[model samples]
Target: MKGNRHPKADIEAALKRAERAGLKVTRDQNGHRWGFVICCSCNREKLVWSTPASAGMEARRIDEFTRKHSNCA
Candidate 1:
């Protein structure tokens, strides 16, 4: 995670992309800053933790995750 002044906005963008991809973003019980991205199509999920990094890094991470889990294993 790079230094990001506006991490939340970037995170929101990533979440939107995931939503468009048929994934759902949910806050995880691990903590307030932790979340889970679930692939509705395959029932696959990934856990993510937000940091004080740039939105670009967060978005990229999300893109990578979605790409990897786009299909069921």
Candidate 2:
């Protein structure tokens, strides 16, 4: 059997993609992970947060949202 696979790898990849898309991921003083995406053209910022278990999801969501709202490549 191949055993069970871990979603950590996929989550990490998503985080990396978010960074490449200009989303900054960070953990706040409250220990919550947050993704901040800022649009230079319109000066609009999108911030999303998630617990440790779903930080990756937040990153992916922020990236997608940022791309749509901002002119990020």
Candidate 3:
């Protein structure tokens, strides 16, 4: 249960990556600086987080997530 302590730029970058991967992104409602990247065709999602220490990793995570779930209908 983390709060929105991460920078807004990081969150926006992650969301943009998710969008580029063809996933729908939505923010967490409980104050976490993270979002769920969902595959509409399969109705599946992956939780992507943004943190100062992991600023550069978000894109990689999104890439991996998209690849892993790419087979979805």
Candidate 3 overall lDDT versus native = 0.66
Q: Give the runs in model 2 whose Cα sits over 4 Å from its true position.
A: 1-19, 22-35, 50-53, 70-73
User: Candidates' TM-scores?
Assistant: 0.64, 0.43, 0.61
Q: By TM-score, who's the top model here?
A: 1
- Per-candidate Cα lDDT values, in order, are 0.68, 0.51, 0.66
Instruction: For each of the candidates, give the backbone clash count.
Output: 1, 0, 0
Off by over 4 Å in 3: 1-11
Per-residue lDDT over 1-73 for candidate 2, one digit per residue giving the tens place of the 0 to 100 score: 1222222554446555655766554433223434344555556665544345565675466657656754544
Clashing pairs in 2: none
Which window of ten consecutive residues has the lowest lDDT sum in model 3?
1-10
Measured on C-alpha atoms, candidate 2 has an lDDT of 0.51
Model 1 spans with C-alpha error above 4 angstroms: 1-7, 52-54, 71-73
Question: Which ten contiguous residues of candidate 1 have the minimum total lDDT?
Answer: 1-10
TM-score (C-alpha) between model 3 and the true structure: 0.61
